[model samples]
Target: MDDPMQTVYVWLDDEGHRTVLLFALAAALGLASVIYFVLTGEGSPTRLQLVLILAAGAVLFYVSLRSTAF
Candidate 1:
C-alpha cells in the first residue's frame, strides 16, 4: 500500500476547511490592518477596497471548497 502521508499535500483538512481558513485569515488580516491604521494614523481601506477584499475572499473560498479534500 502507498504511504497515505506521502500522497497527502493539503495537510489533512476537510473539503470546506480551506474556505474557513481563507475567510478567517482574511478577517484576521483585515482586523489587524484596521488596528494598525488606527494606531499609526495610516490610511484605512476604502469601501471599494473592502468590497474587493470580500470578492477576493469569496473567490478564495470557492476555489478552496472545490479543491481536493484531504
Candidate 2:
C-alpha cells in the first residue's frame, strides 16, 4: 500500500508579520493625515507639508498592500 500523503503548513514569519503591521500603521497614518488636513484651515507651509506626508503615506500603504511579503 502507498504511504499516506504528508501535509505542509504555511505561516507568516516575523518579517511577514512586521510588513503587515507596517502596512496597517501606514494606512492609519494616511487616514489621520487626511482628517487633520480637512479639519485644519488651508494655505500654510505646515498644511503643504501635511499634504506631502499624506501623499507619501498613501503611496507607501499601497505598495505595502501589494507586497508579497505580507
State every prediction's TM-score relative to the real structure: 0.44, 0.45
Candidate lDDT values, in order: 0.63, 0.63
RMSD of each: 6.3, 10.1
Candidate 1 is scored at a TM of 0.44
Q: For residues 1-67, could you state the per-residue lDDT of candidate 1 as single tens digits? A: 8678865645436546656766677776566656655676646666645665676677667766677
Instruction: Mark the 10 consecutive residues where model 1 has the least summed lDDT.
Output: 6-15
Alpha carbon lDDT of residue 56, candidate 1?
Answer: 61
- lDDT per residue (tens digit) for residues 1-70 in model 2: 5433421112244556656666677667666766666778665536555775777677686766678765
Off by over 4 Å in 1: 1-12, 42-70
Q: Candidate 2: RMSD over Cα atoms?
A: 10.1
Model 1 clash pairs are none
